[model samples]
Target: MRAGRKYFIYDVFTQRPLDGNPLAVVIDSEGLDTAAMQAIAREFNLSETAFVLPPKNPTHKACVRIFTPDYEMPFAGHPTVGTAIALSEMAEGNDLAGIFVLEENIGLVRCAIDKLNNGLFAEFDVPQLPEQLPLSADPEAIGAALGLGPHEIGFENHRVSLWSAGVPYIAVPVADLKAAAKVKLNNDAWVEFSPRKSEFAVASAYVYGRETVDHTSSFHARMIVPGNPSYEDPATGSAAAAFAGAIMRFDQPTDGSHRFWIEQGIEMGRPSRIRLEIDVAGGKLAAARIGGHAVRVAEGVLLA
Candidate 1:
């Protein structure tokens, strides 16, 4: 038998185990190259995977690489939260409250870790703020792709828009939770109309509504990653960060620090809540952060 590497499974964006987005964190990723990491990610078959390596700069904590089942990403939210918490829990000292920098392709991301009563929590400021992209696709066409009609497409002052923080997403607003629940993504139509995020990829659809199952939640959302076999993300922090652009453009929150909880993954049964905090100054987004609770669900050795 070969000496295996250590790995952890964490449910992110929720406090409970098996209720949030699941992540695989490969801790002993010193010599694993890009191809090996991608293969490991495919093996886990989760939304995203994180590989931890020794930092090039000793001042920083580690260099974390993020990979989706399909390809490598510049940055991702759940993986950042999950990896930070996983590393903090592994630290030798009990004092876990502090900030550490994780080097990523996007840039150096500063993550703050805190110890909660139930589980550890982590939050990271988005390396790049949201930027609105041009979308020529008609609203009705967008609706049809999601198995929605024009009548149920949007609510007051909300419309289809394209935005990206690190990853791009098509922000689609629906009438209510009922419309959100009715969404069944047609991958073919989505590929036809969505903007290209890369040579081999297009933007994913982010469906949202004001109605939420949790009373404390400000909105309900679902993330649909467009592929041959279309799939839905239960809780997406990157989508929430991108959605902040749509919220600021429409709702126009007062200038200051604002906190909003978005509930997602209900229809899929893995319910999750993502915390979005935006600092508004002069009627513009000065900064933003994505935060969530992560619980270590399983730990084992990866034979690969």
Candidate 2:
């Protein structure tokens, strides 16, 4: 690695700079090993950092590996969008073909970048959805962790379950935004519900209400997994994806472009938005998708 190689980093899920989840992008990660990648992620101290490599199979697309400050992630949402947009912006003049496949630990993921008059839009696909788990029978313990009583948690037809589009999360419904804003990591209860170790499992928390925010129909969220890397993610695409799975499980809302918006981080003052869409028929999950626009917050060289 050269001493002056440049890297581009962006705060994804938010259009404004430094207001979203900060992602460190290592534009040229050729010879850096696993240990070096982890070290670089630690140096950036962000929730996730992307290391881009030349496609192992040129027939595929861009090869990328993702790492958190503590560990590597097989699949994640914002990194996919942010990295694809970065590559699309970089490959403007080149003869790179259409549909870039980002080969990662999860597998080969196809990404498409849209350069519209509005701005840049990046959309990526999750290979498969995580199996749905039954909602938690013990809402009291879960409720107490979020400083809410059982009644405060909504339980009409919706059940809190572990759903995933990429990574899994305990998806629960909160009756109000007030409760959502007060969420903090409940180490004790989370220990019981989360499958992964305390470090990985309890990654983020979300809360949404039908028609809660502006023009957002029937969904608003706040992500609260923030002790180590980030204070709070303004917008979390992975969590949004998980929430999309949860939404499909509960209310398989009508087809014909069922679009909804997710609002997060307003309580903490970051104020991020995520756009969501899903296709369902006869109570079967069909297609789950999430898209968002990313703006490059900062760019500099990642000194190797």
Candidate 3:
């Protein structure tokens, strides 16, 4: 057995522990392999585990690889935010703070950490949003995977399509909040109609509604993938970015910025808030982005 340091991982996406999605941060994983990383992730058995590595190229930012207990994810939102927050916090008493760049496996992501009177907030640039695609999934098939019928979907301007910011997810639009909260992953239909490989068939279901909770607009969503403790994430930045891209493609008003509030994790009792912005120019999707606040709940070191 290998003896090293250990860290006290905490749940991100919420201000308190055990509220949001839990992530394991193995801060000192210098000599671990893919199998070892997966093994450690399984040992922690959280929704996701992050391993930090030294930067391969100094010209870029630091490198980090994220993994679910069972599989490695090319990109993830909470981990990205949480890992940055963790690194920034660790930089205390050191020389790493303010604005920094992370050389993730996906690419170079720029992040800024600022300490405000209220708390710490992190803003990071996601990979450019992807182009919109046609509704590839059969309605019946998509509905089956989501435990919904065609009637429940907002078929007027929305469609079940594929989108990605860093990783891809099957984007399904529901009629309203009620239908969105009642969503259940249709494994059978998902197995057939989903455009992404089985590994990335994490379905993201959302709906647009009037001001509810504490925001002007409410977006309810759920994400489902196999072998993970949490099938539904409270706040998904990656999916939200893709959703903004899809919105720009299908439902942009003639003028001004398209701004909306995205809500997730409420059904699971962990309510999350995300702000999405998209700009459509000349009837083409021009710019897409998302931003939110991240707070540190706790910290620890990894033992190997």
Q: Return the top candidate by TM-score.
A: 1
Give the runs in model 2 whose Cα sits over 4 Å from its true position.
94-98, 134-137, 197-203, 226-231
Give the winner by lDDT: 1
Name model 3 segments beyond 4 Å from true.
Answer: 6-8, 59-61, 94-97, 198-212, 226-230, 253-259, 279-283, 301-304
> Over 4 Å off in model 1, which ranges?
none
Which candidate model has the greater TM-score, 1 or 2?
A: 1
Per-residue lDDT for 1-304 in model 1, tens only?
Answer: 1348899999999898889999999997998889889988999999899999999899998999999988999888999999999888888876667899999989999999986656677999988999999999999999999999999988999999999998999999999988999999898888988888877689999999998899999999999998988888988988998999999998999999999999999999999989999999999999999999998999999875
The window of 10 residues in a row where model 1 has the poorest summed lDDT is: 114-123
Clashes of each: 0, 3, 11
lDDT values, one for every candidate? 0.91, 0.71, 0.67
Model 2, 82-179: lDDT tens digits are 88878877885863234768898878787777754466777776656555655454766666766777776775677556766657666768776666
Global fold similarity of model 3 (TM-score): 0.85
Residue pairs clashing, model 1 = none
Superposed Cα RMSD, model 2: 2.7
55-148 in candidate 3: lDDT tens per residue? 8888654688888777788777777777877787777586435887877767777877766435455666666666565556676677666777
lDDT of 3 at 49: 82
Q: Report RMSD (Å) for each prediction in the order shown.
A: 1.3, 2.7, 3.1
